[model samples]
Target: MPTNQLTAGVCSLLNEPQHTEDLLNSTPIVQILSVKKVHSNPNAPNPVDRYRIIVSDGEHFLQSMLATQLNHFVDEGKIQKNTICRLDKFTCNMVQEKRLLIVLEISVLEQCEEKIGSPAGLQIPPGDAAVTPSTANQTPAAHHTAAATGGATASTSNTTTPAARGQGARSGRGPTTFPIEGLSPYQNNWTIRARVTNKSDIRTWSNQRGEGKLFNVTFMDETGEIRGTAFNLAVDALYDKLEEGKVYYVSKAKVNLAKKQFSNVANEYELGLEKNTEIEECRDSSSFPVVRYNFIDLAKLQEMAKDSICDVIAVVKETGDATEFTSKFGRTSTKRELTVVDRSGYSVRLTLWAKNAEKFTNTDSPVVALKGVKVGDFGGRNLSMSSSSTLEINPDIPECHALRGWFDASGNSENFQSHTNSFSGAGGAATFNRSELMSIEEVKAKDLGTSDKTDFFSTRATVMHLKADNIAYPACPTQGCNKKVFDQHDGWRCEKCDRSFEKPEYRYIISMAVSDHTGQAWFQGFNELGETLFQRPANDLVAIRERDEAKFNKLVEDVNGHQFNFTCRAKQDTYNETTRVRYGVQKILPLDYAEEARHLIELLSSPWAQ
Candidate 1:
């Protein structure tokens, strides 16, 4: 029995009634009599990483553990002899011959702040202490003898080594762990053992709060996955030690709602590592799952809303040439696109950014699995690797292996339909729809594209005529700029732009007469639109024209009489004081005659129709 704290004092509970025992079972106030030198492990193979302290309430004295996390408090002269502390969390467990007092958290009230009686044995009722059946080997009399000198333990030797004591144990049982899904911003005092599946590059950021470097890791277990970040000193201490696919025992982290803008993990909460966080590598990670993936099929990607972060696994049907360009923000970026397909017989585009683009190796159209790709609908449905996204080529996932096998077998024979349109900027006219659309004749009537902003409109037009000679030109191969170029002796040169390129991109700049029932207009089609119209790459057309002039003429004549739903950007330009409306095909869509007829009907029925 122990005295209750009347006012900011100390108290303890009697260890009796076995299962009903209190004290360590509940939060209490205790006074430290002396910090013990060490404790021995008579049963464990090695000593554990923990310390012992003799604590007393006004009446009873007991031996308690100084948790490894709070060892710094003792070294820093914070929790010493005669210090009174309120046990924030603690437990009492019976391990064979030892009754261990384990404290998870504590708050120091003061050290010898108030004068009281000397630390002594519990003052229980006269007969109550003597008749306790819980006292096995030690009688009530021997209990006092043990309390006077030190705790009653099986090992009286002082040979317990620090290595054995550092095993992070006190009672017989080990730390209890919970799943990541059970974690939330409101919960506390939980431990989780998980494997690091992904690790982000160390990045530094600054704001009004402060500045520091941070690295992120995706931790997953059989239950679920969550993200953990270490900052500044924690980064230097833990980053090098934490490797992907390694398991770790972590506890005492600050959990909060995850920021959707930065991560694609499904967890509602993320962890923030603190100085007191206990992270140690686990020798065995057999319990952790390999990973968790909610992969969206390539065919279903087009149905997803824009900006949604999702995962996908598909076989690479083709890969684009890598390109390096400066973004609008003045930051240089590298990019490449992959045309991927799945069993659904449908294809879509995937744009890998920065280092991923530069390091890509699309050998033999490998199966590519990506996580956290941002869905985009610039002109049509597409995918772009997000900053926090991860890319894996020919991964070992089941879907990846299946896709690889299928592509090698029957997938190559089946023609796949593309979910995306022309190329990158074909999305230039993506913002416009049937409502904002106007015919080529209406474009001329309204004097469109002359305003500061280029007027965009879609029309159902047929290629009635095309200039068979010199319909294509050699242009700068560089991405972001497709201006025409000249074939100098050494290489291709764009004299007007004052730039020379080692590789010249063959691009289409064909002059064509597009006609509709309303009227006809001249439209110039560029590389992407030209490729779509002729169903041949600009480079192929250039080669055919150079190899055989008559063959080039035949290819140009092939596109004639074919109708298409075209999205065009109109701009007026004047050369030699002869200003004319220049209609450039921004996007070339499949001719859906029924959809086109319905769209025309809507335009004609409008009140403002001419």
Candidate 2:
């Protein structure tokens, strides 16, 4: 193909449905219409250079990107406005809202001779007439609340009121309410009259491209719902004027493709409140629906993976005192745990964090409707509130009323199935998973022993054998104390509580090999637990072991084949550069056949199982 004589072949490729991969494989020749730098960052760790260019098939203009490695084309002036080039190799991929053509291999077929006819703005292929460009990769929006907007409110006196902003429509000059679904990167002249269903706390972030603070709010109507964020200066401008559950006559909100991970709204696009945005409180909000919630049943929570957001309605079976703790982030946080149960007969712990925890109150068995709670499996399956999540205390919903009635009549203390901790709230008690039971193999599959905090679980296991190599240890006998005392030959020295004792008290430290069908684990049962397992106190065991080695050995053999429910605490420890799960037995109870059968039936009857 000669330079200028390449002809119509350059224009024919625009209509072909073949994309980036096809272009790269075929290496089609094309003409460049316009060139613009879309993104660049000298400070980026890997250094990025991106460009947006409009390529044409002579009839229609299509937007494409130049590969980062091809920056020299623009830097050295090889690619310029009105340049004709062969897209020898390129790739087409969807970057947010736009299908970008990334040119990799190319040759300059012709230099910028003169401006040819400007192809009409990209052709709206049949079904794409209403399609809007993707708003991703645009400048990040700042969503500042009235308080966080800071001095911006006081500095600017040009704010517009709802009536004044809508005056153009009254005059027929038109800034009419724009359909949220009608928004696009192509249009900036839009006015949306919607209700602010929800707004988030202001958050700040700093990055390579820039640094600024932002906040997000969701607006909805009978037609659909959309979320919008205001950044930096814009936050100060629009935040105070907009109120939750209030109607607003909003205009000039920039529309962007909604980031799938961060948004819960079903809309394909979201909006950004900018300086030019006009928002006026509307008088009536009959058009917008109340907050939307598609709650999942509490019984079904076990089926959900961690980090999934869900809503649920349940009765508060129990509540804990609001406690404070210094978080790793160096900030003090409040936490409160609530044991909640639904009609499905399954109960789970719900932990409220920070402000929500501080504000939580349940004097009685109140109905709670939580939205956007995160699924967590700390010690057990639980629901934790997220920063943006919301909860209602005894909401007026039918489910709430039905739960109250059910809980008050029967589901109170003894009837409900508790799938959580052995003791409710902050007892530091051993906990179970959603199934209320776990096999030994699951202990490793769930990565239970690796957490910084000790993990608790209960399993029905048989005691295969006892470790006789090390049985009881001498310890300080002080009441309410369980410290190892020094055997000084003449006298014992107590160091921990700090005191001297004439003689040391022996404490039971039983080691046992226990197993469920899945696997076996070495468990250490200390003092009380050891006493329960062996059916003998520490001093009695010490006397027996000292009295007759053969008698002590028989006691251990007699306990074999006995079964008990073992509550184990697992912690991760690294030794010789390898991490392993170390099990510590906390409590032990005689296995009850009736309780196990009832729990198994409950699991089988769960809605998720169905």
Candidate 3:
């Protein structure tokens, strides 16, 4: 073909060319240039873009072709910019100031002519050396390099090409071969250059079929990402060998539809490692990218709704006592609660029950980093922690240590408080001079209070008043409702509720008059202590008080004038729109007037306030 005729033909085929040049000396080398403008193809629905390239041969022109259909060449090592490429038969032409080219199928010349101290003028050998129609079956040297590097190699013949290996491959069928493009359909035979982003530890479970180990690992490529799992023998073979952040040429794996709700990866299907699965590490760093995240601040934790999963960084403000309880799974486990707070000006309770509690307690002033921890509520406030959640103590992350320092410097440690109340308060009290106090031995010696009004409070009292003989009958068990129960023989009646009940309740009245040098006060005890002081079972006392009022009052007065010394506390209680201060007798002692007088004198003389 004539040079101009071939150039014109190729230009017509490509629609344009940026530049064109001709060389007559030294085997008539032809050079084409000015390839700045190339329009994309509207007909190509997949890639949707096309470019026009220039081609040339020193002598005769072969044929013209479209740039979009040419194979892409990615040079590994650096190449000089605009360096002349030796073409066996090619031409550069222009359509309308745009560059166009046609490449003739020919072998690259072994030698070149010199020009300006640089190689120029592509040279071609005689007839046999030229690539004829039959020689096209020979694969290029680049194809072998690709194969050795575990990359996708183009086959010289259509029948010998490798099968596609990615998505859309039918199960049980061999791999399919396809061309490479910006976003080509993934075939079953293609090997993808991907990196191991994450790997999970192998886990085993046993059932009727058998026991086996399975673990999943996440892989990412320039094109997309997918998760793959190794089962049984694959676990032992690949679990420990797989390193994260390393690239690999992966192919021949099984592909199955993935549950969208279960995974966040972009691919609709996940990969599985089979016996014939191929994975080779890619040493090229430029082929893989790192994972990135925009972590949320710990201070924003409180603003998130309860049960919302989030990441957090906080110092351990306090550690709770480990408690063991039975779980729904029938396992007895221990757990502890820890208070964690950050600069956000709020604190949250983290329950580290069981093994976590034990492990956390061993850390020295731990600062915890939690990922995917669920916010929870305890005692009406927000809390967070998780069992399957990821937790790190004093992680290398700066936020971990920063929060620790802030918590320590802010005196947060000293302000730690329990999340729940464990004790109740006293109601009312009367003060007595120390002189009136007597020991339990003395009380037992004098036999002060009778069995009736046995309830008493006193300072310097002994266990004699606490003896079973001094206790009254039982009281109601309606939480916080401490009214005495009356026995009606058939069952019991509650004074507070004014209702009759089948079950008789127990109660004790710890009422005693305390006399101090400054003043005299009355005290009382209800519920547990009341039953204890009366020396009667709470149920029995409830029965007696309910059915036999005369007996109950007589029992109360028998201990009168006994002068049982006691101590009491006074507190305010509101009922029916009125607030009343009630007195609770704390302790009681049998009086020895002389001994009481002596103790009272000592107390009065003491420097401590009355």
Output the worst ten-in-a-row residue range by lDDT, candidate 3. 125-134
Clashing pairs in 1: 47-164, 47-165, 48-164, 48-165, 48-166, 48-167, 49-165, 49-166, 49-167
lDDT (tens digit, per residue) of candidate 1 on 489-539: 877787655667676777776789989888999988665667666765677
lDDT tens string, model 3, 46-139?
1112223334433322222322323232122111222234434333321111222334322222222221122222222222111111124433
TM-score for all predictions? 0.54, 0.46, 0.33
Ranking by TM-score: 1, 2, 3
Model 2 C-alpha lDDT per residue in residues 1-610, reported as the tens digit of each score: 3246333444334333332333334656567877777443222211234566778755556667675456678888989988888776554432222333556567887786665555554432343121222223222221111111110121122342111111011102223454443344444545766777677767776668888988888786533467798899998887788777787778777667567567655455688789778887766555345655667788887676655667799888789899664433334568898889887888888999877788888878888888767877443457987655678888877777888888888878556554332212234665443355678888778888788997888777888989877788888756556678886765777677566667777777778888879998788866665655565457777788889989988988988888777677888889999988888876566665788799779978999789
Each model's lDDT:
0.66, 0.64, 0.46
Worst lDDT run of 10 residues, candidate 2, spans 162-171
Residue 53 lDDT in candidate 1: 81
Model 2 spans > 4 angstroms off = 1-188, 204-212, 257-269, 420-512, 516-610
Relative to the true structure, candidate 1 has a C-alpha RMSD (angstroms) of: 20.0
Cα deviation at 397, candidate 2, in Å, is 2.8
**Which runs in model 3 stand beyond 4 Å of their true positions?**
1-201, 207-212, 217-228, 243-271, 275-293, 302-308, 320-337, 351-362, 376-389, 411-610
